[model samples]
Target: MTAATSISPIPVAPVGLTARARRFVEVDSVRVPRRGLGQHRRKWIEHGAPAVEIDRAAVFQDRWGGLALPPAPFYEGGPRILGAGCPEGSTDEGWSFRAGSCRVSMAYGFRIGSDGAFGIDAYRWTPLHASTDGWVESLALAAHAGRWAKTVTRIKGKAVESLDLVGFEPVPEVQGVTDTWWRGKDSLIALYRGEAVGLDAPRCLEAHVYGGLDEWGLHGG
Candidate 1:
């Protein structure tokens, strides 16, 4: 899923889901109207956002704007992805703008330095992925694994440290730096170390195991 950052053409991104999004959470994909972006851009300019940067942001919104991803364990405790329908001004962008937020209004946007990597606030940048597709890929992975795993377990704080992961391999598609997904023979473990680091609370460490996955479920059919 290569996201193009251009304004002349209406940026189009694949809806990123098939017929199965309803399995784990009922996901609604809404198309953001291009006409509304003029006002969104005007708002960004008043906030002193750079034009090229704003255009890139606007282009991203034009493409992947309206799909709100359901929250997983480590996500912001609500829908992690924003379905805001338009870009909103934020001091967090430095020169760009913001679009997504969770329960605490913790903002998420594409990073300019990383050429549009999606992440949380400006300070932490991306605790998520190297690109927008990586974010979508993570959601897809979570949905697929969560649906098939017959037994689910959640652990937090110091208990996360005791997990034995000798045979578990990191799921590379997430492109995770701090948080990661580990796939074992029959279990997929989502380890969220970034949460504790971001909030300055060690007890925020979390890990969820999707156990009882068969080969089909583990790798997807």
Candidate 2:
């Protein structure tokens, strides 16, 4: 028998899985909606007054990455990009990425002043097609909240003198679920669940300021 020459198969880069295929956690059942400042602005207007002008320069004051935000371990001095998304610049923008099974959108705006007094309004949204399980929705909500907390920590750092859980409102479909939080002298956390309402009816999570930034928390100076 003629010895068969061993032929190595052509090396092919493995195809990356889609967001849905790589689902490993229950929260992954839901899909994150597209990102856009317009959607967030519409929602803010519908609920109340026009959205505040986000200070892009201030928000990324400590950021080191180029266009896309990097993932944690966040930048030591400021907010770190968590993953690939839109480039930073506009006063308002949307960031979308996968966190476990949950698709998260950190649609936010900010206004930091010379005195360090600032306001940050961050809105989290998921697609209505997300898992209908109340528990799942809650988990997703918590995941997004956690991410937001880290973002706040990175940006405000020790400069945060006082932190607040300003607002935690859910979409109409998820209004039944009550979101709650705890505000200590330095830290605060809010958790809840709801449908991802579009511009027609958008929910918000906001924080107002009384003073300025501290070494690691908001303060009154």
**Best candidate according to lDDT:** 1
Cα RMSD of predicted structure 2: 18.8
Model 2: how far residue 220 lies from native, Å: 32
Model 2 misplacement above 4 A: 1-132, 151-168, 171-175, 178-221
Clashes within 3 Å, all models in order: 0, 25
Residue pairs in collision within model 1? none
Candidate 1's TM-score reads 0.71
- Top of the candidates by TM-score: 1
* Candidate 1 per-residue lDDT over residues 141-179, each given as its tens digit: 777887799988999999999999999998877766667
- lDDT for every model? 0.60, 0.27
Q: 47-96, model 2: which lDDT tens digit per residue?
A: 44323322232132222112121121211111221111222223333422
TM-score of every candidate: 0.71, 0.18
